[model samples]
Target: MSNLEIRDLHVTVETEAGTKEILKGVDLTINSGETHAIMGPNGSGKSTLAYSIAGHPKYTITQGSVTLDGEDILGLTVDERARAGLFLAMQYPVEVPGVSVSNFLRTAKTAIDGQAPKLRTWARDVNTAMERVDMDPEMANRSLNEGFSGGEKKRHEIVQLELLNPKFAILDETDSGLDIDALRIVSDGVNRYSAQGDRGVLLITHYTRILRYIKPDHVHVFVAGRVAEQGGAELAERLEAEGYDRYVKAARAGV
Candidate 1:
């Protein structure tokens, strides 16, 4: 069985208006070395699902449970979840104006690893990860994502993914706003992390372009607030050709 499981999960967010239901009910299981692609329309609860999985405080679990290896994780804090080997590379990576990339990475790595990586070797690891993402090693000394281009921000997330080595990762729309070359570099970095063989990935995207490079073991079409269809990699190609018209209609009809 795959380690990560979400069973009939429902989530709500406390917005200024009130508690807003985001994830109606989501069920999915991901195992080692498997990639699952979640394709959904905007506001279809894709990012919400990722955040709920990562134990984001803003997302309240109204029902169901998320378990890793048999232990329920709904009660875990964000940092606790991270230490349990769960990661979410957000669609929008925020910049820290004063913290250098190297400092942020060092802090994050130590937190995730539960101990500091060897000081001398940490720099080497950071440089290698940066190079894999096509980033200059010099960028490591710059403030984290400060004034970085969209592609640069996304690449920085992949760099963190590499250094943290999380067992399970939800890549929330990491392919957005990338040019062809940037897309290729980001995909390569994702592949590098998946090469670990025991790692699981939930890749959330609106378009299937990234799937062409990093094929998914399964593809799910999420419409409205729930999953509408699912299949193997070929499902992604079908959606690319036909668009989401039929699936959205199907979701409406079912609703």
Candidate 2:
């Protein structure tokens, strides 16, 4: 099925005081070629869920499981999960001072493929990936995400998406901190990547504006770390009109 299944998962972060449970018995599944939007207020554990799935070290999965195509992925390492066909577009991508864009992308492409592409042939494809994302070919020579505009960094992420071609992508607030034109460019690249066959997208956003461009097949309201409600595209419209108070209350009641 090439689908991702997150089954009754609970997450807790360790601290000096003790463990604090964040996600409480969350169950969700997404199949290929579909886009699912996760909308939530702040501190609802939306990003926590995204990072946990991507195998970040801080958040720990205390119970339940996550799987890709029925294979348990909870045991895999961060890079191992990437190689297993999962991608996370962070809200704030890091800046590496010395690493060039081409170098970073080449390493990622190599890791995804599990072997290096021929050096001569690889150079041509890297430029092609840049062009597809509307990135300047000259930027490829600059250090990774260093001294770039907000839009530039976001577009670079899309270039990685095109090059990596992961089966499932969790976009964690990709639309945040962007201007109108930048938002359009970022959404365009996201749409292009989502067009591929059997590629699933799980987009996390606080605003519904980006949904207009990407047109999610389904929309989910995440409250206190679990999906409070789920419906089709119309759900997004309702959220835009009314806001999240009603859903948050319902979620608090365990409805």
Candidate 3:
């Protein structure tokens, strides 16, 4: 079984004002066959935690260590991290004007596997993944996310997750902008990935709706850049009922 561990993670970013810290001494751990949900209000650093662990250059890790199965990952490059079995499904997937979805997926798969996928098997696999996400097969021929709807983009992200089959997947607001149908589709894809029984998932979201479809093993309430509270699935039920008001007030009052 594999594990992803974050310890005392402090991250910062340069804004117009100056270097502003985003994640304040945050810590989290995700193990194989487990899913963890991070819930909080806006600006509580939920996405920051996801991007920080993915080795985004925009965010700097001032203090902390992120390790995958005892190997230090903070020192790896973004692509290196992907090759190391980490996958990130962005909240807003960027458009690649010239790259077709087919090419992009094959290229990414090759990068992570160190060899190109066999053309026959690769084509069949891509089709299967797209079908699982309810995405049209023709989309594989279009430029990646260039003219797709938000639901399509999110669905494409899931396709990648299935094809790559990473050890750990960090999904940042995947449920955003999704309608009921799209949400269920995306959630099912995520569920299929986690159902592999050896994959870990870190799902970050402001709402618990997605949790209804994909239940998490643990739930964390993030406030003021730290995990103010954490518990089982019941914690998510509480957040859905009480909201983050208590946590927000406590954080502001320095409680």
Instruction: Report each candidate's C-alpha RMSD, comma-separated, in the order given.
Output: 1.3, 1.5, 0.6
lDDT of 3: 0.96
lDDT by residue (tens digit), candidate 2, 118-199: 8888778788877776788889999999998877888888888878989999999999888888788889888888888689
User: How many collisions per candidate?
Assistant: 1, 0, 0
Q: Name the runs in model 2 displaced over 4 angstroms.
A: 15-17, 252-255
* 1 against 2, candidate with superior TM-score: 1
lDDT of 1 by residue, 1-255 (tens): 348998888888888999898877788899989999999888889999998898777888899889998888888889999999899999999989999999999999889887989989999999999998889999999999998999999999999999998989899999999999999999998998898899999999999899989989999888766778899999999988999988777877875
Determine which window of 10 residues in candidate 2 has minimal summed lDDT: 125-134
For residues 93-112, could you state the per-residue lDDT of candidate 3 as single tens digits?
99999999999999999999
Arrange candidates by TM-score, descending.
3, 1, 2
Q: Distance from true position, residue 206, model 2, in Å? A: 0.5
Which lDDT value does model 3 have at 27?
A: 87
